[model samples]
Target chain A: MTERSGTVVGPRPPTVIVDDLHVVYRVRGAGRTKEVKGGATAALARMISPRRLAGERRVHAVKGVGFVARRGETIGLIGSNGSGKSTLLRAIAGLLPAESGAVYSDGQPALLGVNAALMNDLSGERNVVLGCLAMGLSPREVRERYDEIVEFSGINDKGDFISLPMRAYSSGMAARLRFAIASAVNHDVLMIDEALATGDRAFRKRSEARIRELRAEAGTVFLVSHSLTSIRDTCARTLWLENGELVMDGPTDEVVRAYEDSAGRRSSAP
Target chain B: MSRDVIPRHGALDPEVGAAELAARYGLGVSGARPSPVEYTRRLWGRRHFIAAFARARGDGQYSRAHLGRLWQVMTPLLNAAVYYLIFGLLIGTRDGVPDFIPFLVTGVFVFAFTQSSVLSGVRAVSGNLGLVRALHFPRAVLPVALTLAQLRQMLVSMAVLVVIVLLAGQVPTWSWLLVVPVLLAQSVFNAGLALVAARLGSAVSDLAQLLPFVLRTWMYASGVMYSIGNLTADAPLPVRVLLDLNPAAVYIDLTRFALIDSFTAAQLPPYAWGVAVAWAFVLGVGGFGYFWQAEGRYGRD
Candidate 1:
């Protein structure tokens, strides 16, 4: 278990405290069953195997990672593809259960991930309304904010694409609308995992401004992006995870530089 | 707020640990499942979303068809026509019931509602992994919405059914109002079955493949194509009673008793409405409880 990494102590009370959180995924298919002594013995041993799921592989996606995010702080998560960055964001957002330890937060964290479309087959207009409703907005409130969501996404500036289903929208347009729907309401803890990576530079800048504004509005925000400059610019603190373990957690510059240096060392060594 | 001003690690001021600080801030475990009452409350808050989702999914399902929404009416009508030819004309299983065509069509329409609920229910949670993983609403919403979509489809079919009954020379009367209660009871029962099916299907991936065969067998046994009395007349009392008491059969019989003059109350079992209501309540509440137990585990691969 890691100790608390922040020295930004103040009356800015804690919003999210992830205490040695562990998340394991039980994936099926393409994993060898545990080997046993002999042929008949192995066959018989499978019947008596203590494992509840036979041949199911256990992927320890997030190891014991701990940190406390206080109010109004933007935390960036940077790591390799399989290094538990997304898993950590999801765990903090309460989408995945912790195999051990826990994530304590003041309120439910709203996670914005790239792959999870609100409703791919529905029109962008319908998706905005449904998204607002799904986030617990009243029907009246949805009506009120409907135009705001559409305008903020800017999908209609080119044409009348908002009336069309999201499946017809370019991926970037979909991502922009998804971000707009999620950011419409101020969540207590907002976690973003590469959700903004698809948009154009102008849209990205507009969203970064929105994220900055949200930092003062919400309890905390956690961002995970492969764009190192995005991480460097958006987040104040950064967490570096490798092979399901947190390799570093400190100021954004220090942690990102350390992660890059390690990658450089690995590439040069071979 | 001064941006990016946080200092180095191991600087928690020594006396205060992270957990202690979180405790002071009154933070609870974020990923913990809500208690049943709380879950119900949160589900209630999502009622608007559920209804909208149900309507959108139900309507858009047939959007790609050439005939558009007409297929909603046509699919079941065509099914009714097939059953009528096979049973009413070829097999002659009418068993002296008056208005046999109406009886058979009503059975097919009502049974199809339950069949659709069970079929979609099986895939409701697992199929919507995108929505399930992306957002946090009650997982029950998917099953409930699926059943509701089926319920809406049934209502459209019901309107056509009313025209069919009128054309068959059935005079309107107070008993016709019974269709409302029958539909309410059946919808609740269907939603309940959906919930139960969603839970089982979420864990057992093979259930989706196996459910149609099971449902088809259920349709045959529920007397959808013929009168139970004629089919089970030679069987023992208990076998007949079980067949009569079957939930699917009970729903179809209630709808028949209300609509067709020949399929009157004496033809039904003792306290038929009571049996129907009981089935609805049991499955509605019990299935919801069964699904709620695994609320947090729905989207796991």
Candidate 2:
């Protein structure tokens, strides 16, 4: 790391630094166009008009949130539906462009989304190879770890399903396979977005243990999940977001408690 | 939980830009465009992935068909049959040209290679949004891999073409060796066109709907069914030069000269090889650079 002036010293060197990051989605054709009266003249007027037939809407998914994550740290993101948790993770993983501010990572962050695009037409065995290769693992490395990947995914526990096309597997099986392929590599930073929510309890426990091992090996893990129990079990720190704003960032128990209390109050009041 | 611990909120000093903060912490900005050289190097490192993707896609194309992989060869053969029946027998495109069957087959197969590649390239990024959004690799890989898959299909089709030519009284000659280089140059050219189409298709989806018409017009003008010489003979010198220099026409002409007994060096344009090589270089390298400029923007909404 090159030394730069005006650096803020922390308790430990930061592996990921998000500085006032904002993410906005410009959704085209989101708003309805005004109806034009039915007539040839009105149709001609509509055609010649400069106004667009459909309008655009801007979704401010994340707004000026900042944080620093150090190596060997696991951070959980807890937010209500449509609260920008997934967007923030995607921004950190370089999957989405930031509308303002920036996210800096010490190494390439691998994101394991719930819908990881392993080809359904391909067999489970083939998708594992493809997924590993897409992650930049050499063919030889994938071949060497092939058996372990299959076992970790546990897709073949029922039978010879590994040889079957991925379309045959249930969503849970596919998500587990995605998680297995993603975790096969010791990524510098791993952002998992609700991948654990699909798996059974046993698989979730295994995945949580694997995440701890990854953290021990000096990798940063960011988990976004609706399941607060999983967050409490895995992350020592948590960030609470509501309506694209960070409401709290502190010890996992405190943040989770605060989030749950607010949610309870809102639900009861309604 | 410790009550005394205070959660940091936007704690970094506001004086420093994100770049300096990243540099000081050995971090790279997310979504930053890599240097061209670095991007190319990373692409090179993923060559295995590209090959695997190509092979899988190539094989997957026919998995649902009863004939399985046999469709690879049958597609071009069926196309050649339709053209042969329509243009060869009915319309009499074979009147002046000797060995018209081989010539027609060669032109159809060659042109179809580029056409299918470019057509597939249009959907390469837009169709594979799932993969693009889920993973982080060079987005160009999708286009390149799609082209490679088409190239493989073309190779299989070429085998059937060789047999048809052999049966149609076209004997092997020293010039037949030229087919290899001709195919190589055409593949490079198609790959380049595919890259351009991928970017354009992702940006403007209307290209997909408009592409078949465009390609059909291009094919008719490329002298696929007849000699380009006949079309340009009475035109002005500038028009003649342009027709002779057309890349697709040059490629088809090269293959005809290599395969058909009637197509000779005299019928070829001046410096045909030079024109073919120049098109390949210009389009291949140029399209790659153009596509790389949009690397950070492919899967975004």
Candidate 3:
């Protein structure tokens, strides 16, 4: 196997290229209902489990999905629940396994999700440093950017409490700090999943501007959200996924209009 | 943020099946366009990330403590004294065992490290589910970092153990140097076990709760508190061999012999160390192989 040389990403590079991706989840059968003798029950259950007999069935999460995110591209993934949007984002971020497909990336990718909580036992401020290291940033870089991360988070006077531990802060405060740490650096490929949904309007405005700054620096961002307004306001390109397949991929206005019309018709019909 | 790390190149080469490389290296089985060398290179390249994570986790626990990091030293000290009192003074194993305090302390302390590594390792990746879901880096880093941190604590405790040995009037010998390689082997073995446990711990978190109990049982079986050879001599051949299969035994026995300056001649055969090393290597590499096979799926809830 020949080593691939590391290269710097730029505006012309394809930051993310996914082809023929198919993702499936397999879960083990639990709590046997089959009646049997005590010792024999376990043995019989194991033998009868689908995982042992014919292999666990795969629940298709994303099927035959293909797309590319070039440098300077801000793509919004819009879909309803169970539409495979999150799974597609996870596959692209390299978090979820695909049954048969390929996702190539120009550089390291970071997935930012709403559930990505900092170590709450550690103060809000310390989480900033922890988050930076988790993102693969060097100590020197963390030191260089520490002040800016705190400033961007806008939770200054919390001081020693910021240094105290995360569990002390409210959920909103923790989210704000985590968001600051994650967005502190402009990444080559950044994927966001509904993280912007919880923060107050002012913080959301701040986050949108920060994302714009990231795009201006020739970075590619993938945002997965149910909010058409956020996607419309931020992304240049919009992707519509339904039932584990790509339904549409085009400019934001075109896709959003189609989605809104369909949604409106469904609501009115009932 | 470091532009230097990003590759300036074409999209992944088409000739190779990048999906195969990904599956082989614990990347996502599907849509894995990672190059053939990406696995090894990624690990090598992220050396800094490993170090940073280790240091951060090591320090993270202490940052909030009122006693600060002193607990690192104090906790092991307490364990040693408690065991010395129970196994040394009260039970009176001191008369039967040479360098009773030394042997018992080293065995107990080292066992603690191994236990910590394995117990924490089973939960290592799962405990960091948040980070795993959000970041793209080597999944092995979590278990490896935790094992290294625990190893660091063992080293410090070893130093304290050495002082206790000298103070008790036991003469140190050249065999003391042998303890280093033996301990390294044990460290490797512990690390491997941790990786396996971490992977298993995810799907069944109940296993994580059960692990420490298992380790505690293993400690007794491995002769941390009692002499297994003496206790199992009358047992059947298979049972004795089962005791032998307890990997921690070889390590704890070797350390005890080293401190008393008697292992090479009167105790376990020379080849036993070699067998232990081989076991460590097999388990270390084999456990990693098993864990890595489930790499991309580890982050799934």
- lDDT of candidates 1 onward, in order: 0.84, 0.83, 0.73
Model 3 DockQ class? incorrect
Which of the two, 1 or 2, has more DockQ? 2
True contacts kept of 3: 0.27
- Candidates by lDDT, descending order: 1, 2, 3
TM-scores of chain A across the candidates, in order, are 0.87, 0.87, 0.83
Task: Estimate, for each residue in B157-195, the C-alpha lDDT of model 1 and write its tens digit.
Answer: 999999999999998888989999989999999999999
Task: List the candidate 2 regions with Cα displacement exceeding 4 Å.
Answer: A1-10, A30-53, B1-18
Candidate 2: docking tier: acceptable
In model 2, what lDDT does residue A146 have?
Answer: 94
Native interface contacts retained, candidate 1: 0.60
Give candidate 3's TM-score. 0.79
Better of 1 and 3 by TM-score: 1
lDDT of 3 by residue, B114-137 (tens): 899987798798788877776666
DockQ of 2: 0.41
Residue pairs whose backbone atoms clash in candidate 2:
none
TM-scores of chain B, in order: 0.94, 0.94, 0.85
Q: Sort by DockQ, best first: what order?
A: 2, 1, 3
